[model samples]
Target: MADLTIRNLTITPLELVSVERFQGEKKRTGNVVSNVTGAITGFINATDFSAHHILPKGDSHDSRDVSFHLDPFRTVRTDVRSADPAGREVLRLTFRAGDRRYETDVPSPSRKSSVMKRIDGDDDVDDALDLTVVYVPTGAFLAIFSSAKLYAWMKQLDDAWPLPLLSIPGTHNSPTCHTALPSVRCQSVGVPEQLQNGVRFLDIRVSVNTDNDTLALVHSVFPVSLTSIKYFSDMVDDIYRFLDANPSETVLMSIKREGAGRGTDQHLSRYLKAGFVDKNADRWWTEPRIPTLGQARGRIIIVRRFGLDEEMARSCWDGRGWGIDGQHWPDNCEDGTCEGGHIRVQDFYDVTESQNIEKKIDYSRGQLERSAEREFHVIGPEHDHNPDPALLPIFVNFLSGSNFFNATCWPERIAAKVNPAIVEYLCIRHGEDGKGPNQLKVGAASTGIVVTDWVGANGDWDLIRCIVGWNARLQLP
Candidate 1:
C-alpha cells in the first residue's frame, strides 16, 4: 500500500460561508384619525420605506458605502393576490430618484426598475433619474444573517486551520475507544482509550473573513498516553511521518497524560528526543505540571516501615516473590535487611491512620493491615520540588472518598494544563432562542473567525478534529 500524506488533500480546498435570516416586523396603523391629517402623518412617518440620498450623475459610488450597485436578480412569486392591502389591486412599486415624482399605473410594467426608476419617460422624471439610487438599504442588508455565508467564511478560515477527522469506536480491554481518521498519506497513532478521552469540548461558533491575500495555517494536538512500549514507539513513528508529509502547513500536537503512573515529562522528552516529534514543530504548553499524589499519598506511613514502590518493584523483579502479582515496591525491606524491615503490618497501619485500630485477627490480619494503611501511597510526593500541586489534595481526598470532592475535576485540571492556549470557559448549548453566547468560543479579531471546538469526547479524535478544522478555516497553504 502507498504511504499516506497530509498535504495533498489541503491544496485549494473548499471554502464555506454562512447566511442567517430573521422575521420582518409588522407595521402599525392608527385607527383614531380619519383622512388627510392621518394619511399625511402615516405617509411621512412610514418606516417601511424612507428617503436616502441619490448622488448626482457622473458621480462614482463607494463599494463600501450603502449606495453601491447590485446586479438585478429575478424573483418569481406564485401570485400577488393574498398580499398586503395598501396596494390592494396595485403592486405599489415605489422608486426614488433625485427628488423627482413619477407616478403611473401598470398592466405589469415588466421593465427593469430600481429606486431610481420613475413612471413613464417624463422629462422631469428622466432628469431626476439621471442620478444614482441605492437599490437595497444598508439596514435591511445588515439584518440578514446568512448561514451559507457563515459556513463559507468558516470554511475559508478552516482552510488554514483544518479540523481533525473522527473515527469509529471500538472496544479495547473492556474499555471504549475512538481513533482519528488516517490522513490520506501520513502516519497516524493508534491512540488507546486511556490516552484519548481526557480532552475538553466547548459549544461555540466562529466566523472568518479571508478576502485578504494571505495564507495561514493553525494546528493543535490532542495528547494521549501509551502504557505498552510497542504502542509508544508506533505513535512516535506516526507523528514523525505526519510532519514529513506536510512541509508547507504548520501543525500542532497536543500531548496529555492518561492518568498518574502513566508517565511524566521525562517520558515525553525521551519520545521527542528520539525524533518522534518534528524539531520544526511549534509546541503549545498545556497542563505543564502533573502531581504524583495518587501513588504517594500514604508513603509517610507505608515507607516508615517498608518503602513503597521499591518493595513492589523488588517483588515484581524477584523470581520467588509471590505478593502483589509479582509487582515490586520502591522499598528494600521486602529482603528483611533494612532498618525498617522488622516493623509489623499492624504497626504500619496504626502509624498511617488518623486513629488507632483496636480490632485484631489471627487469619489474614497482618496482610490486611499492610494493604489497608498502604492504599497506593505511591501516588504522593517523593521530594520537595513537585510540579503538580493538585496531586497531593487529590490523593489525600481519595483517602476520604467523600462525595464532596469531584473525580472529574482532577481530570479537568490536568486537561486544562495540557493546552495553555485553550480558553478557560465552558461551551454550553443554547436554549430558547437557539443563540449561544460568545464567552465559550474563541475568534480572531483580524478574520472574525470562530474557533472550532471538536464536539466529541476529549480524546485524540476531538483533538485532531480541532486541528483539522482550524486548518480548513485558516486556508493554510
Candidate 2:
C-alpha cells in the first residue's frame, strides 16, 4: 500500500480532440479522434528485476474488461536497519511481477553512521529494513494508452442514488407545501466493478428559476440543498459486493444532485477533516476531494444575479475569481475571464445585450414571493450507512447534468414505479424517440434541452459561496 500504484490512465473521446490529427489515413480528415495505439516501457536498474512478472494481457473483445490478472506484479516493503541517518529503521523492498521480469531499486534507509553524525551518537538503531513496492503494469511500457479504469470509474459514478431533498422549515404564517418533483440521475462513464473499491462519492449544488420550465422541472427532480452523506456511505458495502461478483463486466453507478440554485448544508470542518484531511481516514474507494457539509451549510448558492449591462456584469465579474479575462466571456470565465471559452447560454438560451438569464431575474410584481425561500422534496434509492458523508453532495451535483436531453424526469419516472399511474405517465411521455409521455421530447429526435426565465429583469447576480470547479481539480490525483 505504501508503494505508488501505477493506475491506468484513461482517455475519453473528448480528450483526443487536441492531441492528434488524420489527413488521408484510416482516420478520415473529418475524424479527429484516434485510437492512439502505443506502448509503455519502464526502467529500473538499481534492484533485481528477476523476481517481478508482467500482468496478463487483456482479451481481444470487451476493451472495457481489461481481462488482466489482479495479482500485483510486484511488492515493496520497509525493513529495519542499523546505523541509519534519522535514527529510524530504514526501508528495503522486494519488487515482484509476472515472470519475475519487472523489478527495480527503491530509496533505502539511511545508515546509522549518517544519523550518528547528525545526532552526535544520540541513539541506537535496528539492523535491517524492507519495504513493499507493488506493481500492476503488464509490459515495460510507461506511456500507457489504457483508459480502462477511467471508463470503469465513470460507470460506477453513473449508478449511485440521487441527492436528497432539503427540508426547509415553514413559518406559522406561511406553511410549507410539499410536492414530489422529478429527480436527476448521473450516468457512469463505464468501469469494471472490481476496481471501484476505493472510489469516493461527492455532492454539489446547482440552482434554476421557476420560469425555466424544462430546467426547473429538471432541477426540481431533486432538492439541491440539505442532503445526508450518511446514506451513500451506507451503500458502499453493497456496491463492493456487486462489483466483486461481476469481475470483467463494466457497470454504471448513478447518483443524483440538487440542481440550479441549491447548495450544500453540512458541518464544514468536521466533514472536511473526515474526507480531506484525516491521514488515516478510510477513503479507499472515495473520490479525491470531498465537498463537506461545512462549505454550504445554510444557503446553497447555485447561481447569482448580474446586471445585463457589460459594465455591471464586469463589476460582478471582477469580484469573482473567474472574471479576470474579458475575451473569453462566460464559458471561459474559469477566473471570470473571456479567454478560450464558450457560454453555455449560447447553446440553450439567447444572450441578449449581455444578459445571462440564469443569474438575473425580473419578477412580475404580483407573482413575487415574500422571500427567496422555498421547500423541496426529492425521492430515490435511500442510502444512510456509509462512513463518508461528503459524497452525497458531490454525486448529486454532477448527475444533474448527465442527460443529453431536456426530459430530465428519469428519476421521478423510476420512483413512480411505486405508484402504478405515475409509471404509466412516464412511459407514455418518454417511451420512444419523441414519442413518449412528456410531449416535450415526443416530437423530435434530439437531446432534450429545457430552459426558461423566471425573474424578468436582467442584471448581474452572484450566488453566494461559489467554489470554482478548478479549485476542486487541484486536490485530485
Top model by TM-score, which number? 1
lDDT of 1 by residue, 167-206 (tens): 1111111111122111110112232221232211111111
What's the lDDT for residue 59 in model 1? Answer: 23
Cα lDDT, model 2, residue 462: 7
Model 2 misplaced stretches (Cα beyond 4 Å) = 1-183, 188-230, 235-266, 272-279, 282-477
How well does each candidate superpose onto the true structure, as a TM-score?
Answer: 0.22, 0.20
Q: What are the lDDT figures for the candidates, one per model?
A: 0.20, 0.20
Runs of candidate 1 with Cα error greater than 4 angstroms are: 1-230, 256-271, 274-477
